[model samples]
Target: MKYTVSIEIAMPREEVIQLLADPAHLPKWLRGLVLHEPLSGVHGQVGTKSRVVMQMGKQKIEGTETITRREPADLREIPKGSVVHFDREIVVEGMWSVVRDRLTEAGPDRTLWVSESEYRFSGLLMRLVGLLMPGSFRKQSQQHMQDFKAFAEHGKDVREGKG
Candidate 1:
């Protein structure tokens, strides 16, 4: 399955990138995240692999996420009109996924974030879920983007249990 979701954040591109690149700020926006720790290399750097655990209601999903690409190693100075790219591959017991994210300046103080995700499932149960409920995956992705926008602009923390 493949789908793309996007949202506009009321923040500069650089500031958006900074927040997204920082592991310290992830839990604030990424809902249901239980733990994310680097297993090799540095967080956000190319080739870095991290263990990710997310809680979804009564289900717990654990996976390994590997950073495949990051353009302009330095996020401190991004030239105007240039887009920032972040790509990662995630692997779980019965599923493999790749997510490509792009960030561009929408205006003086606004950023546009686009995320494209693709998934491949192994095993009958996983494949059935993917085939039957593809919209759920896209909905989840959009929710994350919306959550991040809220966190970036209004300091809303998903862990706080308040919207």
Candidate 2:
């Protein structure tokens, strides 16, 4: 499955990108994310890998993510000025997922953050979830974006929305 979601943040594009790129800020906007440990390569660089653990209710979900692409916003001549891009491939259980993030400057003090996600499932259970609960994936992605918007705008945690 593939879909795109976006949110507008009341912050400068560079500030939004910097806040999003920093690993230390993951827990602030990733909801259940409790751990993000770099395992190999340079952190945030392409080819770098990391283990991520998230606590969802009583379940502990774990996954490994490989950074596939990282592009600065200012250096490109895209229609939108200063639109950064980041791509990561993540595998969890029987699921393989790729998420691409684009951060574009909407104005002098506003940013537009977009996320595109693709997910494939191997196990019967996972495939069923994909088929039946596709909205779950999109909801989670949008939640993270919303949380980030709140965090970037007013320094709030994921649980503390509308910051």
Candidate 3:
């Protein structure tokens, strides 16, 4: 399944991108995120790798993400300036899934974050499980987007002495 959502942040694109790129700040804003460990590379640059763990209800999902694309902030462009794209692979025992996030600046102090995912079931049982839990996937993705929006906008305000 594929789903996407975007929000306009009240802060500049650079600030938003910078905050999103930090691994430590993820759990603060990302709902259900319990752990984020950087495995390699710089904080926001390409080639960075991290292991992320998120919990929803009684279930916990673990994944590893690698920065595939990182664009520098361009103040002149304001909102449409920079973008950060990454690919994440989630392995749950026998089931494997892949998700990609393409986050870009949209307007002045606004951002557009899109997440696309393609999941492959390992066996008939896994396929059946996916069929039964379709809503789980969609809900998780949407919740993350909402959390990011709140975090970025609020974070911007806090940083600019607005809060």
Model 1 is weakest, by summed lDDT over 10 consecutive residues, at: 154-163
Error of 1 at 17 (Å): 0.6
lDDT of each: 0.95, 0.85, 0.65
TM-score of candidate 2 to 2 decimals: 0.90
Candidate 2's displacement at residue 19, Å, is 0.5
Please give the clash total of every predicted structure, in order: 0, 0, 0
Q: Which tens-of-lDDT digit does each residue in 1-163 have in candidate 2?
A: 9999999998877677778778888888889987899999866888899998989889998999999988853333445575578999999998999999888888889888889999999989989999999999999999888787778877887655535
lDDT of 1: 0.95
Model 2 worst lDDT window (10 residues): 73-82
Scored against the true structure, residue 22 in model 1 reaches a CA lDDT of: 91
Worst 10 residues of 3 by lDDT: 154-163
- For model 3 the local lDDT of residue 64 reads 74
Model 3 ranges with Cα > 4 A deviation: 43-45, 72-83, 155-163
Cα RMSDs of all predictions?
Answer: 0.9, 2.8, 4.8
Best by lDDT: 1
Candidate 1 on 33-127: residue-level lDDT in tens?
Answer: 99999999999999999999999899999999999999888888788999999999999989999999999999999999999999999999999
TM-score of each: 0.98, 0.90, 0.73
